[model samples]
Target: MRLGRVFSVIAVCFFVSACSWFGGDEKRLPDIPEQQLYDEAITALEQQEYETAVEKLQMLEARYPFGRYSEQAQLELIFAYHKNFEPEAARAAADRFIRLHPSHENIDYAYYLKGLTAFEQDQSMFQRFLPIDIDQRDPGAARSSFESFSTLINRYPDSSYAPDAQKRMLFLKNRLASYEVHVANYYMKRGAYIAAANRGRYVVENLKETPATPDALAVMYQAYELLGEQQLAQSARDVLLANYPNYPLKSYKVKNTSLLETATFGLFGSESEADDPPRPTTEDKQGLEKPENEAQKEQETKRPWYHKATFGIFE
Candidate 1:
């Protein structure tokens, strides 16, 4: 009985080995002709099969590196990667194309694609509908996108993509300026008055004319006030008031709270609670508070020069 069982086990093992030898893996599709592969990739792209298009384009590039369709295939690969949501691959392909054919007629397209890829990469799905402020997030990708678009604009001013690139650059500039303000705000919240003031000053000096400029000035004013730099605070406030008359600076003052009130968490404080009703200020009494027309004017002034020049077409 033991001998019969061992023979059966041996037979089962041999059958398993035979099955593995014959049915290892499915065969790969035969290599398609370069022209056929390119056509297929285009067809897949039209069909919105981005993954298949990327695969076919990559294969076409590998199989026909120097073929007649090579240059076109390389360019298509960047778009394919982008459509497939592979931003890093798209950027790499674009860079490669630009490096390989710097004087190519389609070089501007590569630059535009690089910039677009960077722009898309920086955009989060949450930003589409959420009220999230992009300034609070990392600005690395935004900076890169801005640089890429700037390069495209400077190098190919007359290119078809230049107009769009210029528009994106304006947005990126404002975004970066806002990011600086966000950092300054963070420092202010942490009581790092000097650092906050420096960041705010940086935005005012380096990112002039951006929508965040007024906010940057406000931050600088508040930070300097907290740091006891009354002169600097006054300077910032003057600039902010001059440029943005409707900017609300009434809330920038530091509240005076006694140590006893601080230690007691305001329960036994002499000062009124923050939520309690308060008397109107001098501006309110003088009818110099923010008016609806002033708010509208603020919005109008905040529009970038391009937006004004384009008559809100780009906005």
Candidate 2:
């Protein structure tokens, strides 16, 4: 009986294996010609079918890793990923291409795309239409973008992308400077006057000619004055008065973010944390038969009309 049971188990395993083999064969994609795959990917890109383009490009690379169009496919894959709003994938593809083909004639193009990806990494789809303060978001992506552009310019000064990269670098520098002043303002509101002063000094000393210079000098003046350093305060004040006498700069204020913002990064949360939470399960029975449950589906919660239209980005 034990031998019979063992044989029965082996027969069952063999049947399962045969079924899986047939299933795999049925689901396998057709093997298209190398040139045909690359052309389809290119056609999808031209039609702005980014998802389809990404699918074809990815499949081409997987199936023809060393084909005639392999390098070009890899390069276009980065662009496809970028157009599909897959910044992380685009960055990784760009990095891989750069590493594998350091001497490629189009290496500067790879660096340019890497910088472009990082340039918009911090911005969500909602930010395209919403006038949010990007400087208050994060500076890491901005710095990364700047470094990529800088490297491209330094390594390939004569490359056609250098001029555009120079423009982007200037914008990044100003954005970074503005971000520093924003942080300095935050420190001022927290009463960390010394730290605020240091940040202001960094902007003024390291990032010159930026639009935020006046704000930085103002922060330094206020921070030093608050710290009882009259000499340092006067020096900062002197520079401000000398350079931007007409600019009306004031201390920046701290804002209390809405509690609902945690879900959408401060774009949708309008209610404060002080508001009452959902009722307890024990105290929820208020109806004649059964009270409506307070813990309902998050998607069922009522939101503003604008939020509903723009929630896709947050999602």
Number of the top lDDT candidate: 2
**Which residue pairs collide, candidate 1?**
none
Candidate 1 C-alpha lDDT tens digits along 1-315:
999999999999998898667875445567788889999999999999999999898898888899989999899999989888999999999999999999999999998898898898889789987998787899888888888898988888999999999998888889999999999888887778899899999998988999999989999899888888899989999999999999888545445666766766764344333343244566554465556876686677666545654668997
- Candidate 2 segments whose C-alpha is farther than 4 A from its true place: 1-17, 20-22, 248-315
Q: Work out the TM-score per prediction.
A: 0.69, 0.70
> TM-score of model 1 relative to the true fold?
0.69
- Name the TM-score of candidate 2: 0.70
Candidate 1, superposed: residue stretches over 4 Å from native? 1-29, 251-315
Per-residue C-alpha lDDT of model 2 across residues 234-271, encoded as one tens digit per residue: 99999999999897856544466655665668666554
Determine the backbone clash count of candidate 2: 2
Q: Clashes in candidate 1: how many? A: 0
